[model samples]
Target: MANRLKRTSEGFISYRFAAIVIAALFFASLAGWIAQELVPPDFVERKAFYGESWRPGLARAVDLLRLHDPFHSLWYRFVLAFFFAVLVACNVSRFRRIALRSLRAELPAGAEELRKRPLSFDLSWRSLAAGPRGDADPLVRYGELHGRREAVDPAALEGFFARVSALLKRRGLRVVSDRADGVIRFTASSGRLRSPGTMLLHAGIVVITIGGLIGSLFGWRGMVYLKAGETAPLPPDSAAVLRVDEFRIVTGHGGAIRSYVSTVTILGTRGETLAAGSIEVNRPLGYKGVNIHQSSYTMGEGEFARASVSYRLRGETGRRTVELRGTASAVLGDGAAVVTALRFLPDFRMGPEGAFSASPFPANPALEVEVSAAGGAQRGWLFLRHPDFNARFAAGIDLALDGVEPVYYTGLELSSNPGAPVLMAGFAAATIGLIFMYFCNPRVIRGIATREGLIAAGVESRWKASFELEFAGIREAIRREFDESG
Candidate 1:
């Protein structure tokens, strides 16, 4: 039973089955590529796969399949896994066969097969005496001219063939010779290792697929917002904490935002500092396996630090500006009135339940102040937009809201892809395999000895046009040697 199961596994992993699997994978990848191109980059965060934007049924299907994150989808991973398995099986099966073929000293071919090759040509005594002629030369030159030429020198022809053998050897070709009944046969081949170039190419792809599998299984990406002077814990799997030391924005001459920078500090699990640096729009910080990029920033008054206000009295000659925060009180005129800042709100609004703050944004800013003087004490809100709001208070003193400083928070995008190294190695290997397959092309040339002369045939279909030129050169060389032998 175990043997049967093993045989079944091997059968399923055979080249025929593997080709089918590879074709299916190609279509699957094509479908995934098309689907991904239609979706926005942040489809998951923006919740784009829902509601009226997308039809209900299509949205449900996309959501169920996690099509937004196509790279990590179950079907994508399964296809990669299957393709990798097929590549491994195919390489294993072909490797031994290729190795054995390369080891053979001679490869016999049928006469019909040799004649069918495009590079095949029959040479006879009369043809050899006619000198070298290009295939495009006029056919009248081959008529029965029967011109008298010096008898061929056997020693020079032997020397020429020996020279040809040496040239093929210099070019890394294995030359094999066989002689029978006064007929000499020869075969020359180069780039034997490249005989399995196809298998190597597929093996490189398998490595790349394995890399993708690693990334899909172990990689992660997300974005986090950190206010100035705030520390946010990293993901549970990550053993570091990210602190936003400062968020600075550089403005141009016209107050246009030129650039934004975030000073970040990385801390270990026990609060020990590990690394600290600044990250800008195009620049990112790397700590351990996590990459932190300054993605965006928000302006708000969540942690109000200070507020400025103008203070004056009924008989005051000049107005004085007071900076209020944390128990700062100002006396109006001759201490007749007092004003204290209880708290600061960058954006102050009334909630549904009459609460003070409606949101964290500083869209509508207001300051809550306490006033006490002479006969009564009153409390009210001072708004940035309303300058004359202090006139409503008749407590013998007036206060005007000037401006409030807002806190800026920086958003960081964090990503950890553990498979990046494997992917890079796979890419390098794939490039090498491609160079071997195409650049160092392997070719086979077979020569069968006949009573009249030598019949040469070459396997040149892989690169027909290029091989045609190469065959022309070889033919010229043979003709030069044989003609010189005369």
Candidate 2:
């Protein structure tokens, strides 16, 4: 029963289980992107684009699944949570094994165990005395005496163990030795932090997952539009106010829009400035944990529009121009008549009820004006594209909308995530862990040193081919030392 339970526990935390959970999370995220980003929100728009055949059923399914906000949906969150749990379990299980292996020193009990190692060699006084025959090839020389055991000189055995320890120490390994049952054992290692570095990488991933959960649960995002000097309250229960100080559309050489820039200020509830800066495309302003980005811009409406009106006395060829901003009034032609600009509309249209703007784009600009004279007051709409429509409004005055320049309002997207700093810290930790794990080489060498012979084995965490050559060098050096001692 205990063995069954252990097997079940191991299977639950295995890499296969973790990979399955990761795949589920990936599909969930993909579904979220398709629903929220690719699909239109309006049912009519969706029907128009995707065809009306499958619209109703698809829309109903999307709504039922809450696919419009999948990241925040219960099912998506559940999947993510499950993945996180699996990752934590796997990391914990692996970490225990790695820690035990890396922190403690263990040696083979006897010659049989040492011989089973991939890079193992046995040397005796007789083998060292024989040495290499011709070119002194380390690989060939070690291969010749790998498993042979012969009687050894006690003094020579002591000298050989001491010399091997010194050589490993010079190569930056921490060496430890033990003596038991008429045999001396030695273990040496380098890059002890490599295992811990791997664990740090796993820990960083766990931290990043936690940070993402925090952000997904508590963060908020919204958009606000503000003209110059206009202020709007920040969204999602924030007491701060976001004010647009200025907005400009930077144009390139051919009069194409290069970028949209907005100079803005963040004010506290008490109207004190909390932060202030300029934000353009790809540049965002950060205040506390909130980020404000310049998203878009549109032609301003109402009081933000400036209009130029040209007027003349009836049947007169000469005309006079008066500048009018919003509903401000200006006298025309020797102050005989007053013209008040009541409203301005971009993309103007007349509906069943009255005049209105179809859209914010300046496709068909129009200006509403009220002309007052000694006879009476007449109100009329002057179309900038068609001056003839304004002819019959007043008896003795001619009015025309000569030109209209639009002021632009900046569109800004604001988002706040309390876990952003934590996420950044996780990324930094993961980067350091990667550098340590990849750039540093960790290796271990173990051997049984006895009066009869020596059996040594070495292994590297990576680059097995290179470490094999290094191990051969160590064997050759030991052979040379014994030869000199002789």
Badly placed stretches (over 4 Å) of model 1 are 1-23, 33-80, 98-113, 124-126, 129-157, 166-185, 188-197, 219-223, 233-241, 249-261, 268-272, 278-296, 299-406, 448-452, 484-486
TM-score to native of every candidate shown? 0.63, 0.72
Worst 10 residues of 2 by lDDT: 43-52
Q: Report clash pairs, candidate 1.
A: none
lDDT of candidate 2 over 61-95, digit per residue (tens): 66667775677778997998898888888888898
Using alpha carbons, what is the TM-score of model 1? 0.63
Clashes of each: 0, 0
Predicted candidate 1 versus true structure: per-residue lDDT over 331-412, tens digit per residue: 7667777787765565576677742656556667777788888778787778888665543567756788887776677889
Q: How close to the true structure is residue 119 of candidate 1, measured as C-alpha lDDT?
A: 81
lDDT of each: 0.72, 0.80
